[model samples]
Target: MLKEERYSVILDLINKKGILKVSDITDVIDVTEVTVRRDLQDLDQRGLLKRIHGGAQSTHPIKLEKELSHIEKKNLNLDSKIHIAKKIATTICDGDSIFLGPGTTIELVHDYLNVNNVKIVTNSIHVFNGFIDDPRYELILIGGSYRNKTGAFVGSIANDILSRINIDKAFIGVNAINDNTITNSNEDEGMIQTTILNNALEKYIVADSSKLNKRDFYQFYTLDKVTAIITDNNISPENIDKYSKYTKLYF
Candidate 1:
């Protein structure tokens, strides 16, 4: 088939399905893996689609009004989360006070922490539970109206408590980062994250590659406010160049 015909087929599949693997295109178009990859790369360069590790996803922003439950989000990008968690863990030092926000990616940071004499403040039940039995750390759980879906505490009470304390560092997660804004699915949760980030000496946003260029329901903060964005290495070079123009990125 001609390249133009192959492009049309590939674009139709991506538009309908939102994402398509190289093999998926190959199966339908009778093209080799190399040819499919070339097509995807060309389409990505033209801004028609986004090139991911093994697939091409739509470039359109994903606007989510409701977030996935904790269990559902835990395994979505497990390997990328693990890599980002390990990188974030190295930034913590002994005797430092930190704030951890709610999210599956942030929750994984607990497994890689090797620091001692650290104090942790959080509104996440999952985050609190991770360090509850550890002898070297002090854990403080912010209490408020609990959200069952995210396993987090979010309300005026949680915001009030967070406002009174200042921490050395804060690691917050988000539903999406699009253009210059960082957003969340819930307004209350976004307010709490904003409060913690504003009060901390250093602020970091933890997100995977998939969260880049996406949109959520509520805008809480901007890219310029954070110290840096810690993401996985799977982020495309084009995105790295684009986002890095606004803030630092640690992959």
Candidate 2:
């Protein structure tokens, strides 16, 4: 494809999908990672999209793109998720009540939780399945409509459940955050997440490096809503410093 055509395609990708990872663009455009990086640079220069560490996304109020299947997300950022997950694991106490969000990164929290006698509640079916059978943790699932693409429960039922439960710290997952806001790809899921955030004593958000400065459909809360955010090392120290003025940002 010509440079102009590729440019349009890149814009289209970001518009359709709230966030476009580097690999996702390369896969769609049949180009080298280096070539894709150049394309992203050009797009960012034109102010059509913002260049992230690993991808480009639209500059408009972020919206959910076509959601990915659970398997698709699980392996996308394995190492980064593991690092962020490990940090989150350390924050939990033996008897603390916690709520986990419906996100692949948040899924790692359940996978790594080996603590004895901890009560965990979630609207994530994958999270529930990961630990429901483990007798060491008291796993409670907030029943709601299942999103096949994400294997998460959201909507009214999930919102209702979150309202009734009290959690010490809720680990909310996010797709992107701008200066002051935390947003998600799915609108309905954002609604349920807001409920979880409102009820928790402390809320922690887990997202990898690529999500900073990006925005998506339906914001759940602002930076003040959470006590801290745990992200991968790839996030810029400059960005972390900017975010830290509002909330504790952990790498």
lDDT by residue (10-29, candidate 1, tens digit) is 88777645567899899999
How far in Å is the alpha carbon of 11 misplaced in model 1? Answer: 21
Evaluate residue 96 in candidate 2 and report its C-alpha lDDT on the 0 to 100 scale.
93
The CA-based lDDT of model 1 is what? Answer: 0.90
> What are the models' TM-scores?
0.75, 0.73
**Model 2 regions more than 4 Å off:** 1-66
Model 2: worst 10 consecutive residues (lDDT sum): 60-69
Each model's lDDT comes to 0.90, 0.83
Best by TM-score: 1
